[model samples]
Target: MASSLHFLLLFSSLLYNFSIYQAKPFNPTDGLIFHVKKDVSTLQYVTEIHIGTPLLLSKLAVDLGGPFPWFNCAPSSSSRLVNKRSIQCLAAKPKTHQYQGSNKKCHIFTENRITQMAIQGDLVEDIMAINQVTDGSKTGSKSITTVDYNFQFSCAPMLLLNGLASGAKGMLGLGRTQMSLTSQISAQLSSKLQFIICLSSSNGVVLHENGHRSSNFRTKIPDSMIYTPLVNQVETPHEYVINLKSIKISGKKLSLGIEEGKIKLSTIVPYTTMESSIYATFTKAYEQTATSMNITRVSPVAPFGQCFSSRENDGTLVGPKVPAIDLVLQSEMVKWRIHGRNSMVQELLG
Candidate 1:
């Protein structure tokens, strides 16, 4: 659990530095910036994307773990007029597969095994726009400058996500695969093939297309930001893997079972979801630490394992004051500190 907590701590610290990178000079015509909207109920960030000739507004989940962009669309007479038009123009042509390797059939399953969204139609090129602005004047309404591009994307006819992905209409994959949006639009970007996602309270998230380069054209990294080399591409071609040394919680170094003459523990940054067993291991250690500190534990929340009773009578869950947790990376002499909201989950009773 210390390792998991430390991972999140490290991620948050990097996110803070990324927030500063978002204040650079951005040309609306050169690069596209999507306005991220965080869903309070699901804690997922979504953005609006316009597709087709008349511009069909569709909400898509900002998923970095996914490899392809798709939406929940079904071909039916009762469907919306915009969707029907989009389907006719996008999927009426001959079916074209967009997967890598020899797999002709493209089946996309979410991290949660319960829901499966399959790509069922031809891959077609269509106009995709982000950050659309409208001017409301007394004369008439007009659209401001928007970053639009004609890109190829999958049109999913059968979407079985149920309510698991109700936070958005579909998912926009930013993965490393060729079918991802980032790879498709790599020619238009000025910097390296990289992006930054900065989450904040003011603006949900500010995503920079070129995060490595500063405004002055100098390649510089912040002092607080730590750099770790990505793992070998031979091992993980479509994922960003990094080396993790160990985790320390309250001066206690948790063992990661590092054997002699073996490679250190390498982990991938799971942008979307992780297994329950893996999450349980960390939560178990967290609960044990809370108990040792004489912190009273309450009934278990649905998803969250560790929960404490609030002092007030509002049935609000209180966060326990835990000791500092550190995540040590094997790449460099980097240790990230984890505390506060990054290590605790608050549950409210209705």
Candidate 2:
């Protein structure tokens, strides 16, 4: 189970670092870049964006799962409204209706039905400035740059705020829907449907449009970067899905049972909640491997099983060295290696 858990974590990390690009003209000089602020605890990445004519600085969560970009606005807040005319154009009464290009309809909060806030607002064009960072020299002097773009976005007047954190001002949607950020900016770049996100080890994350670097933004991937074909979800076409065939640990194949079941390998969402049956099967196999290695197991770590104790008293995890993991995709001869720090994570408790 521990090994499988480690493999799952590695898979999530790889997906997090994965970049999608479309083949097109090589400009190397035109692109929009934005610096992302990541919250380690929730793994949420946010970036500052300026909206409206006077420029209101708003922090928006970068979400790959959301289909539309929207910002919270009080009914009377001028900062959220682009102009007086835009605010006056809103519907006189909130109506329960479906969003454009989606089948889901808005529903009022009730005891039996799920509580949902009806999204009511005007679609208006606004100038948006994305924050970026540039390295001055090899010594790492940094400079801030703002890339401005004009696009239409939704301003939700009655957006729900009960479950959101105070820092979450809005959401910058990156899903495959037609109203997403990718679609809104497709006309300005050569690669009409692609973008890249490179998380930094330092203070901020970087976003590249069309997978190309401009004078202010640049990134390079290793020559050995692997590529995989993405699958489509017929019902929810806006979601990103991929295929996986099997999982192996230390060169030994485990019974993933993908072929015998109806599991489509459609979703590869991060921070997934595994089914108990699947979790138990992987756990049993992991425990068997650990026992065969003659390694002593300690008390189970909270939220994680099969943790071994360290020799020192600092509450650091030490152990039987974890083995390499490999993810066998549906593509022939395509196996992603999970090694080094990705194969094992050491957590310290205070």
Candidate 3:
């Protein structure tokens, strides 16, 4: 009995020391994290990181921005917490082109601006042009005044949580609780740059509890859609207005945005709690977005149809089902120029 007591004392001391070490912050190169000790079934928090050169100082305007209303809107059978943090990030770029007779020559000139939810970090999402446009135009040329816009957003990947892993113990997490995004315009053309903005994210979560260790039970990257520009010639401002159309993920209709020199879309659909079942809504939303956000809703389709377990009569699926969610997106630009010194003029696309 005495020996057993001594061993128990030593084990308690080790656990105490381990808890102290866990209390310290974990700054991984990937992203920041929030660790909680208590057993919680649901947790929500928010953080924002910048998305540009670290030292480059410039103000951005949010032409339009909002939080992703839906995120992992379902419950888990294990000791895992629920999360519903919605976040949106947006950036804009401009392109210039000229039309010459039967032969139409085009050049795409662009500048990038980023905006996102306010969070407590200095981290910024880095962006680089997949396609460069330096050779499109020359400096100091008398070119027509038009701009081409590009947008970018990053959804930090899941942690592959230990709670969901084999021999699990506890769980920890961080989410985009709430956010607002906008675009900053140089003084001169701010007024004329009118904007009609919309922001959304078909955000969802994949939870692993219960040690259901199947390779299929992994977090999957959600489906995403964006406004793609087509080649066209423009002479007046009227010709610049491309008809506003819907952005579909998979095949479901998702939110969209429009402004001169810009187009934007949501990665996922918004959350509406008034509905009967969050899970059902999510399943349907995923399919629609996957179909490019334009399809009929299909629910109680798969796991629901099954007895939930091949062996147990508990009516629960042995494996978890995670759908491809919409990635968060934001779009903004001034509809009309705001009278001021167009600091944007100093922006060199050459």
How many times do residue backbones clash in model 3? 68
Query: Which is the winner by lDDT between candidate 1 and candidate 2?
Result: 2
lDDT computed for candidate 2: 0.49
lDDT of 1 by residue, 52-169 (tens): 7667788776665455566654342222322323433332232343556654332333332124334344344567765422222333432334566666555554343444335466
Worst-scoring 10-residue span by lDDT in model 1: 259-268
Pick by lDDT: which candidate is best? 2
Question: Which parts of model 1 have CA positions greater than 4 angstroms off?
Answer: 1-31, 73-119, 132-144, 200-203, 211-221, 232-236, 258-285, 310-320
Clashes in predicted model 2: 2
Q: Worst 10-residue stretch by lDDT in candidate 3?
A: 2-11
* Candidate 2 lDDT by residue in tens digits, 280-333: 666677667756755456788666765654443232232225555566766547
Candidate 1, after superposition: displacement of residue 164 in Å?
4.7
Error of 1 at 253 (Å): 1.1
Report clash pairs, candidate 2: 1-283, 1-286
Arrange candidates, best TM-score first. Answer: 2, 1, 3
How far in Å is the alpha carbon of 118 misplaced in model 1? 3.6
The TM-score, computed over Cα atoms with residue i paired to residue i, of candidate 1 is 0.65
- Candidate 3 structure lDDT: 0.20
